[model samples]
Target: MDKAGSEKSIIALEGWLQTPAGVYMRAWEQSCLDNLTADIFGYNAVQIGMPEIDALAASRMPYKLLADRKPRAAREQQRAVNLTLDYTELPFASQSIDLVVLPHVLEFSTDPHQVLREVERVLIPEGQVIICGFNPASLWGARHVLRRVGGTSFLPRTEELISMPRMKDWLKLLNMGATQSRFGCYAPACRTEKWLHRYAFMDNAGSRWWPYLGGVYVVQAIKRVKGMRLIGPAWSRKTAAAPSAVPATNKRREQQDG
Candidate 1:
């Protein structure tokens, strides 16, 4: 999508996030991100979108930035160095950022593949990227399908839902390995907070029995650079030669003659 279209969709999403269902989804996403980003050590970390949740708050990175198209609304919701820019055309230098977080950005983008390409460009080799999105294999996803099929839209906008497998493929194409993945928020699609709370038991059950069926998923990927190897110093290799075994037997005889 163009910049104006993307911004409008995000604004609508922010409003929807104020509802009970959206509130529940945000809480689940926050918990997932807290666990995922806790150990992501780096010099610079950037959250590409979703200012409603501070994706880098738990990170210890000295430099953290939040980039989005809507800075005014983001400033109201979060406290960080915010940058207004298009996801497909990031202003940062290549391979400079150590980490990037995209929370529900792919599904809402005009060209999700291009967004991923931009993320790949700015992220340093071996850097980490954490992504959170709606799972197409979950109850919430089923509801979305039903709604769309019935000529209605329940989500913030009419966007494509990229499944986990498809996302893995995209990452693989960029030489980024999927290090870890998590799924949570196992509640049915209920509009009211009370109904959502009533089905809270599904959280525990879904975790143990059907974890992958959760409404949301978080995937952490690390960039892999080819032909990268660590080697010891040349001096160490030169000094590593061993003595000949034949010299030991003549040493005692030579000493006695001396």
Candidate 2:
């Protein structure tokens, strides 16, 4: 889709997320909470999503909220913390935050690059940004196909389902060097049989063999240092020296020519 169309689609999807299917499709988000909590245990972090996540992080470390809308309950639940702000334009000063957790934000963002740039802007030099995304090449993605063909239509059409490689490229563009990446949710997207679902945990074993096949992928990247400029004089300083004032230069040239 074109840029404008893509933006509209993302906004539409964001609104649809409040629905049941949207909620179901996004259930994988909760699975990453454990990882996020572990990573940001004692840092000034920002939870950019539903308000409930703010409360979830309250007991552990200092965290603020940044969502499109004000979550009244979330605000009331964490009354002591008043750091709520807009995601597009954050209130924090440049390079102020130590950690930023992106739980399914890429999937729903109209402008993923802009969001990532904002993440880069708010992060301190060498700060870390943890991102979670669904793998389009996995069994889970295959299952999504069935849902689409079957007319299940749980959530708005996904704007973009990026693979790990693309995400790595984005990190490079934003100057965030990817330090580590791992996959999760190995279970097949569709459980045609009951046993398949029953043995879903077996997918975890497969991860040992084929880590990329996992339904979800997690990447941790550290902001890289900026490039430096070359410093030197524009012109050579010795070029201006006059050739030992040759008064007989013409005569010497005539003699050599003769």
Candidate 3:
């Protein structure tokens, strides 16, 4: 999608996020992100898109950068951008970033694969990336399908919501192994907050009964570089040939002189 179109779509999605369904998903995502990132210590952290929620709010990283695809006015955004650049082409140096949070960015991205590649490129070895997205194998996903038949769809142009399995595959290809994953927004899609509150019990029930079938998911993955070794002190090993280094003839001569 063109830059303008991408911006427009995200704006629409942001608007949807203010509604009852969006609020339901947003609160769940916020809690997940908070718990996941709170204990992570890093020098640099960046959050991509989803200005509605601060993905790194709980992180104690010295520097936090909020980036979006386009330039947004400060007053207009709840989570304003610190940098405005293309998602597929991040300007940061290779292996420079410590933590990256991507919230609902992949589904709407024009080149989602390249975006992941860019994330892999900027992330330092062992650095972490948290990704949040809509789950296609859920009731929310089914609603999108049903609504499409009526010549209307409430979801942003994310026609193909990426599933957990597919997301795992993408991470594996990037060498970013998923360490932890959580699913949220268990309640069915509802148009009003009253209906949403009525189904609030579903959240706990779904978590225990059908955790993987939630409407949204958050995955935390670490960038793993091949051939990387752990940092530790070098311990010297005493060898069997150590005593042989002292010439036997010299020892014998010394004994005879004595």
Candidate 4:
């Protein structure tokens, strides 16, 4: 889709988050968070985009929220946290954040690369970044298709759902190395049975072998020091090559004699 269309789609999706379909999507997101490691525990972590989820996750860590606005429920929770500071221009100093959880913000951002760079700028060396987003090529996408065709409740114009490889490339571009990745939420479409939902792990074996096929993708990356120059360039050598030794001119002696 065109850039304008993509932006409209994202806005529509954000609005739809309050709908039944959106609630299910958010539930899936929370499920992803439930599976996250406690590595952020006791660390100065920053959660961008979703204040409600951040508020809950940060309860375990020295956490803060950075977003465009504050959720009313989050404000009511009074989670001992800061709120609504622009993520694009964060208030924290360089290398201030110990961890960052990007809960599908990049997919909706106008400049995802810039956001990643800002994330890199704030993250401490070797700091972690956990990203969660919808997989473009997965069962989730198939569900989206059903939602469209069957006229099932769904938000129109969800932004460009990026692929896992593209997301890895973005991390690499920002000097973050992928440490681990996982996929979850394997519940089949049209199967609303609670047992079926609980048995989603039946697909876990396939997920282990092909994680990219799952509905949602989660990736953890660590920032690394980049572009250090310990040694000078080879061209900086001072010595020049000496010309090949030439035969002594015997003609000079013959000329003197003449």
Over the stretch 1-258, how does candidate 2's per-residue lDDT look in tens digits?
655675565566656545443343344445555555565544577766544333234226565445543434433323333454555677778988877777666776666788899999999887788787778877666655557577463334566588999999999998999887878766554423464457567566867887788777778888877774556674654454445446578779989999
Model 4, 99-142: lDDT tens digits are: 88887777777667777888999998888888987776776667
TM-score of each: 0.88, 0.64, 0.90, 0.67
* TM-score, model 3 to reference: 0.90
Is candidate 2 or 3 superior in lDDT?
A: 3
The lDDT of model 4 is: 0.66
In model 4, residue pairs whose N, Cα or C atoms come closer than 3 Å (at least 3 residues apart or on different chains), thus clashing, are: 9-157
Task: Enumerate clash totals for all models, in the order shown.
Answer: 1, 1, 0, 1
> Between which residue pairs do clashes occur in model 3?
none
By lDDT, the candidates rank as 3, 1, 4, 2
Report the error of model 4 at residue 236, Å: 33
Name the regions of candidate 3 deviating beyond 4 angstroms: 1-5, 231-244, 247-258
lDDT of 1 by residue, 1-258 (tens): 665777788888878888898889888888888888889888999998878888887898999888876565425656554798887899999999999999999888888999999999899989989988888899888878887667455566646687888899999999999999988889888889999999999999999999889988899999999998899898886566535545876897899999
Q: In model 2, which runs have C-alpha deviations exceeding 4 angstroms?
A: 1-43, 50-60, 63-86, 145-156, 190-197, 227-258
| Worst ten in a row by lDDT for model 3 | 232-241
* Residue ranges of candidate 1 with Cα displaced over 4 Å: 1-5, 73-77, 240-258
lDDT of model 2, residue 190: 41
Cα-based lDDT for every prediction? 0.85, 0.65, 0.88, 0.66
Summarize candidate 3's per-residue lDDT along 50-73 as a digit string, tens digits: 778989989999999999877666
